[model samples]
Target chain A: MAFEVKDVLIVLPAFNEQASIVHTLNDIDKNVPGANKLVVDDGSTDKTADYARQAGAQVAQLPFNIGVGGAMRFGFRHASRNGYKVVIQLDADGQHDPAYIPELLRNLDQSDLVIGARFAGEGDYEVHGPRKWAMGLLSTVISRSANSKLTDTTSGFRASGPRAIELFAKDYPAEYLGDTVESLVIALKSGLTVSQVPVAMRKRIGGQPSQNAWQSAVFLFRAATALIIAYMRPTDPANEPHGEKS
Target chain B: MTYFIGPILSIALIAIIVTQLMRKRLRERHALWWAIGAITTLFLSIFPGILLNLSSWLGFVAPLNLVLILGLALMLLVNLQHSAELTDLENKVRTLAEEIAELKLEDSIGKVNVSDFPESN
Candidate 1:
């Protein structure tokens, strides 16, 4: 089977992001022309799906409000079923710079997974207080478990090759299971090459941030605990056998 | 009247046993705490005088029944939270499984030969 390199799909997960979905779509169309864009509207009560569809992107409306993890899983399934050679996860709140889409896509040729590291670049952007603390705790745990340096364990901007899309589409933690960080760990443990690319992040365009101080604290505790459990759990054969295949 | 104590104790023991059995299906960490609360309630109910001194010290405002009820309420809240957590986890697993199936199909397709299809003559 011949695979075309042009079969890359950019997936955006949005929840009640009607305000910024249009701008996010425009940025992707402008920055990554000809690349297919998919928006997973996670049961947004607002007009998120309508605006996303009007913005010239395919939209997948979940039946209920699944978190970021669920939305991403939906997008991954769409990308996989449609035969996308590469899948790029872009945030719908416009914090991720779509301009770096090319750079992320370019890096995927060398690595199975390429993560856009927000903390890797020079520019300064405000990190939400709760997210900052959560990231700090997660980074420490990931560094210890994977024995790999990860500066931005929680950044939503990421690019995955066919291999990664397959792995994540299968076992991606969908509910408060530390999706991004856990995916990274799974990819590394499976011997899939992982790399980080520096990308500039912008402030959110609209809508209140998903979590407040109390919610963020709770999320942080849950996410950190999930990561710890994942680290200690026995590795499944499906994940380990891939290493032998490679 | 003295024999009443024996039947009350037996009923409390049965309640405790039933709750312990039900705890196996409950995911909340507070179930164990609630069990403790129940046992405490039973003990205090059997010997009402044990709480008499404490109740008097608090001006009888902090009645023993109020304390037991509060503990039971807390346990109920925790159990509710646990149920919510379990539901969330189950939903996550269902979605994950669906996504995984889709990806596996894509992976298998990559290894197949599409050229086998005949071109128009």
Candidate 2:
């Protein structure tokens, strides 16, 4: 039962990323040849969908912007329906290198979810101020919840197997900070095994970084709130370990 | 003269409610509660002795305090219901948006409106 590259779906959630959409698609093709590529256009005003279609990736255009959480939920449902065994979420800004797709998928053999973590000694990526503090605290708290040490809980680059895919497609949170921060909590709480691999992050090929200094400061508060809510959520039957449906 | 103000205000509220209902600006389900409240207030205002007796029975030292409390409680209930409805709508909208994207992807084959199918490499 060997897994083929074609069985993996690489999902890129792009928001007004017309500048780098084509380049990112080509990079994925070059790195993971024959792998299926899907670009969920989050109501980009620019020509992101057009460019992605031109570059040979399936484009799912959302009618309006619903953030990355909404776009990724659509992606998971697409993968689940289309029979993709593995899903790797990569950023459209080209910050995530496609070279690590194989490494992530390889880890999926043993674990249900694999995260391409930035702070795990692979790259010299650094954060400062409130953002750094928030990341550190989140890693500590979530690592305890998952019963394993996770150095990067907020990394967007991750791979999900069939179990994680089924759960996420059914109940992925669509709130602010829900995609990255809350998704990890949901996966771990649902009795899925989670692991991380170190990967170097690159500068965006185009478009501005979404966060500012003020946002980073506010991120500390928002991230904490999101975590509290995730923890306090009534345990859903779907979130329980498989076959324990109540 | 001042004692008549309460009855006049209650009558104005009832008139406004009826006008809104006739114009279809408010759903009957929502206006039902407001209409009942207005009519009750009108009855109590026209017969102050009834309000006085009820407030005394309810152990209120002043009838005005009872009026204020009832008004506050009604507003709180309305606000709470609105918040719940808003959350429900948000969830529905998210699901619809996702379904729309899914259907568009399905309808994309042989359609020129969406992105062209990438040529087989």
Q: Backbone clashes per model, in order?
A: 1, 0
**Each model's lDDT:** 0.74, 0.89
Model 1, position A151: C-alpha lDDT score = 75
- Fnat per candidate, as a fraction, reads 0.04, 0.96
Which residue pairs of candidate 1 clash? A170-B100
In angstroms, give how far residue B87 of model 1 lies from its true place. Answer: 4.4
* Clash pairs (backbone) in predicted model 2: none
Q: For residues A95-193, what per-residue lDDT tens digits would candidate 2 score against the true structure? A: 999999889988898889999999999889988889998999899999887777788888899999998898899888889889988988888888899
Query: Which tens-of-lDDT digit does each residue in B15-104 have in candidate 1?
Result: 766766676754345456666666776677677676777777767666766666667787788688789979877876667544443443
Residue A19 of candidate 1: its Cα lDDT? 85
Top model by DockQ, which number? 2
| Model 2 spans with C-alpha error above 4 angstroms | A210-213, A242-246, B14-25, B28-40, B43-73, B110-121
Q: Residues B1-121, candidate 2, lDDT per residue (tens digit)?
A: 9889989999999999999999999888778778888998899899999989999999999999998998888878778877887888988898899998987887785444444546522
